[model samples]
Target: MKEANITDRQKKENAIEKIGEFHRFGSILGLERMNELMKRLGNPEKELKCIHVAGTNGKGSVCRFIYSALLANGYSVGIYTSPYLTVFNERIELDGEYISDSDLAAYTDEVLEKVSQMTEEGFASPTEFEVITAIAFLYFARKGCDYAVMEVGLGGRGDSTNIIEKPLACVITSISYDHTDRLGNTLAEIAREKAGIIKPGAPVIMNVDTDEAKREIA
Candidate 1:
């Protein structure tokens, strides 16, 4: 048991080290690399039903509420959110249970292998968020989650999470002035970026109070 525990610790440490490698490149906003990574992984994101939530604020709250409602109804739900409050495992959960350390380490190893292969083929390496998003999709799909509530990590358009082709619902909550440098300088511009999460034929739920933002999202 002592040996097993030590091995587990090593795996976790290795996984964290690999994750740190991604931060060196910083956040390059674009879906092309994300799309390529997903495609290489057989597009696990398409295998599950998902709710895509985007906005400058309250996205995590909206995802939590939706996940809670689904779980309360006896459905298996997965949640993928960013900026974890404590640990990286908090960013991915199944039925309110954070992924186990063993699983996280195993998935990180698997993802890193694929990413390395992609690099060999001349594809740009995915960012940290993109890798985590891919792992969440794979986990949710493998776990057979009935619903997955995915929170946008950044602006909707170029964010890594936007690789999801279509979602059960597209939710934009309380869009405001934020990410102005990357999203835009004005409410309309920000709204346009947030609206990018709205997929075709998917119902959109909006809670933005700004008329200009609402119009742009509409």
Candidate 2:
């Protein structure tokens, strides 16, 4: 299958190789493989309450808000975001702290063992986003986080984070002009897509975006 571009950083002959392999087979937006992978990991997401945030922009900000609020409320919060502001490991946090270099290294090994087996068994390796997502899940689970805030890596409808069957709530940051090639145009259309997060009457918060966007939310 055709693949997305691989980052130059993956050229390294180390743990990131698994990350690269993941990108190779990670195409076609769906929850089957992700659900399977999460199950193999024993559904760490089940024991955790999560705030899943998604939108074109301001997603990270929304997650930051939820994470901080959860922390201030005396809850241990773990956060995971996409396209880190700078460093890759910055994407994963444990109780308001970034995952340590040593922990990232160790976790990469654990991630690789599972990811490799998945690939060998004819499962897609997962995308860069998916692999990191898995690592984030494992970290949060192992670290005993009370809640984890996850920002969708792409459209909410088929995002890897959707593998989490339950969440404290779903938050759509702002629906605007971005990723149109995948999400479609018109606020209503995009809203329909973002609305995928609504889990059968689950509580949702959409405090950003246009009136049309809000209409879509309604």
Candidate 3:
């Protein structure tokens, strides 16, 4: 029997469903897969002037504060945060407006197509967060954002958001032993992962409380 045709809405739903499955797949660190995915999407992250935020807690709040300050200063800002309090659309936004549903679906479709191509070419599909990060970057680039405040979804070094090789600044909020399972148990070790968001030559605003963590971050 011939395969049934799907509508664009259906395509969008399928794409979103595929991304939803990433949670089951779990978080996978390492930049290789993220790099491959970005390459397929034309590397939108490179076009952005971003402020990277990393920490066990308060990263989301930090991102929001920076975003607000930038908007108040008349800069067009893009926001990328995770574990939204409400819907997934809250994670990617611009100029204080969440990404529209149609826009989200459209971008998801495009990204999914690229993912399929990657799979065909022997590359693994990007994790859900990775895909969402790419979409945010693409959306920001397309909308001409003056700055993007990006909150690291996981530990900094291998986090998907770390793909931005050159950020305007790196801000490390209060580092703690919250993600001991993924980022290590000690303050120093957690500080190291949080510090991974630091790009060489990029100024860092660190607010580490623990002396060991502060020293390690410094």
Candidate 4:
């Protein structure tokens, strides 16, 4: 039993290290690579019923609220958030539990195989967040989640999480002036980018306090 635990821990650590290697690719904000990668992975994101949340602030909190609400109502919910507060597993949660180390390692290896194929086929490598987003989609789909609360990792339009075709609902919370370099400087420019997650026919819920944000999102 002790040896098995050690082996599992080692495997998880190795998987995390392999994922970290993609950080060298930096944060390229586009969906072409994500779209191609998902195509190769059998398009798991399409299988999920997602509630997409995007904003300059409060999106993570909103995700948690929705996740908790769904879980409390007896739903199998998965919440995918970025920049985990502590461990990598925290970024992918289901039913109030972080993804197990064994499962994380297994899914990471599975996605890494697809990523390797992409590079071998002469496609650009996925960024770290893109790889993580792929893992979340795969995990949620395979786990038979009833719904997924997906928090945008960055600006919604080009962010890796925007790859989802349509969500059950699109929520934008409190857009602010942040990530000015990547998401643009003005509130309206930022709101437009954040509004990228809004798909036609999907209901939108927002809490924009500024006229600029309201005008752009409306």
Top candidate on lDDT is: 4
Off by over 4 Å in 4: none
lDDT of 3 by residue, 1-218 (tens): 12322354455566668689766657888888889988989998999999999988789898999999999999999999988887677889999798876678888878778888988999877888888888888889889899999999998999999999999999998888787888888989989888988989999998888899988888
TM-score for each model: 0.96, 0.85, 0.92, 0.98
The candidate that achieves the highest TM-score relative to the unseen native structure:
4
* Per-residue accuracy of model 2 over 1-218 as CA lDDT, tens digit each: 12311332333235556576656654556777777777777877788788888887789887888889888999888999877786666889877688875677677878767777887999865777777788889889988888899898888888888877777789887788777777777777787777777786568887655888888778
Clashes of each: 0, 1, 0, 0
* RMSD of model 4 against the true structure: 0.8
Candidate 2: stretches off by over 4 Å: 1-13, 25-27, 208-212
Q: Rate the local accuracy (lDDT) of all candidates.
A: 0.89, 0.77, 0.86, 0.94
lDDT value for model 4: 0.94
- Of 1 and 3, which scores higher on TM-score? 1
**Cα RMSD (angstroms) for every candidate in the order listed:** 1.1, 6.7, 4.5, 0.8
Model 3 C-alpha lDDT versus the unseen true structure? 0.86
Candidate 1 TM-score, true structure as reference:
0.96
Question: Could you give candidate 4's per-residue lDDT for residues 64-85 as a string of tens digits?
Answer: 9999999989999999998888
